[model samples]
Target: MSQQIPFVDYLVLGENPHLVANECAACGARFFDRRNACAACGATGFRKAQVATAGEVRAFTIVTVAAPGVPVPFVAATIDCEGTSVKANLVKVTPDPEHVKLGMKVRLATHSLGTDSAGTEAIGFGFEPLETAIDGQ
Candidate 1:
């Protein structure tokens, strides 16, 4: 896999860093990373697309193992957007698996995707329960 990099100033069209992916104009399939050709139909038709900013949690898993740059017992999930589904880590949720489940309505939240000591930033999306958005009052 390639290192995470920023290809555009606006990560996603709407606001607060929407999870941006790409859809094939030929087959109408969505995939990550900007592509020049459709992976499904081999057509030179593609455009930048963004996933639904809010969706329900289709599945979830907790990571108790440690790895580079990732903390132990972190939560991850398969978030089902309006139509397309993408796997992403859940942010601002309970660090416990018992507290998460399928069909939980989760909202999109932005995170510092990645960072280098030199101060470069990469912005990506995460999931936050709707109440978290309101509780920061």
Candidate 2:
């Protein structure tokens, strides 16, 4: 049976993207989520801020172990994007995973990890090796 979906968004299409966040007017602060108040100075005014799509891998770990049906040696990294960044898992592209190092530029892309309770998978985006990032081919 087909599952119903609420909304679907496509991120990190061909090039890296801006995860569009908000910046505080009072304090020099930025956040990924939209908020009515400044997290740093409680200012209600904000401006549109875009986070860097491409970033270097700040940190990573080799998962010698994983959950059921998952493969071991998978890599998880904390991407350091411009301004505010987040951690993401590399998918679809592998570039000498063993030699993967911190501060390596990577691109963001959407990956399929099966449906969730909402029956949708594009709820968020993930990072992939820049070598595999789509470039309007």
Candidate 3:
């Protein structure tokens, strides 16, 4: 069996997959990457904060152009997970204006992105419509 690993360090894969962010101790600002100082308050302290699994679409664009071998016509969206803004792809839904809209509820989801020569599988995360998540479709 191959070992599965998250494509990003912030993604936690298990029974319940979720993302963790680096929160500024002083200003409550959250970031996905490590920061020596908080951009909001210039605080040097940080803590690990778990991001909400559910969020609403704040903005999105249907990308029809991409690098070679990459799929086109995918929905790239900015999700507001609680108060944190998350940039991810909308999966399991048609990448059309009629199908995707602002304020659409969504939740975290993961999929396998094949494996490497070392037999290690990489898992990538995305957001899907909340209705589909609830209906298990």
Candidate 4:
């Protein structure tokens, strides 16, 4: 069997992939990366918070340009998940205005980023259309 790992420390990849953020206990601000102090309130105290899988698109953009070997016309979005805004890629939908819109529901989804020669798989998470999330393809 292949070993599975997350693309980033904040993302937990496996059969049930989920995003974990550090929350400021003082101000209730959530951060995706490790932090010494809270940006919102400068509090040093924090707690690990598992963000909601479902969200609504608060903002987005269709990128037409990217680095070499990177695909273009991908949707990058800010999703409001249980009051926390998470910035991630919007996948499994056409990258068009008609397909992607603000206030559209979405849910966490995982994809294979690549595999190491040692048979370890690196996976990343993104938000996909919520209605189809139940199918879990």
- lDDT scores of the candidates, listed in order: 0.74, 0.66, 0.97, 0.91
Task: Report how far residue 75 has shifted in candidate 1, in Å.
Answer: 1.2
Q: How well does candidate 2 match the true structure in TM-score terms?
A: 0.63
Per-prediction TM-score? 0.74, 0.63, 0.98, 0.94
lDDT of 4 at 122: 88
Off by over 4 Å in 1: 1-10, 13-15, 36-39, 113-118
Q: Please report, as a residue range, the 10-residue window in candidate 3 with the lowest summed lDDT.
A: 25-34
Evaluated with TM-score, which candidate comes out highest? 3
Please report, as a residue range, the 10-residue window in candidate 1 with the lowest summed lDDT: 1-10
Please give the ranking of all candidate structures by lDDT, highest first, separated by commas: 3, 4, 1, 2
Query: Tens digit of lDDT per residue, candidate 4, span 42-67?
Result: 99999999999899999999999999
Per-residue error (Å), model 1, residue 72: 1.1
Residue 134 in candidate 3, Cα distance off native in Å: 1.4
Per-residue lDDT over 1-137 for candidate 2, one digit per residue giving the tens place of the 0 to 100 score:
43432122223333444465677878868775668888788889988766777888888876777789887666788888775767667665453556587777787666454677755543356677676565532
Arrange candidates by TM-score, highest first: which order?
Answer: 3, 4, 1, 2
> Global lDDT for candidate 1?
0.74
Q: Model 4 reaches what TM-score against the true structure?
A: 0.94
For residues 1-137, what per-residue lDDT tens digits would candidate 1 score against the true structure?
23444435335633355766787877888877667787778888777777778888888888888778777777788888897787777888777857787888878776666677766666676788766777871
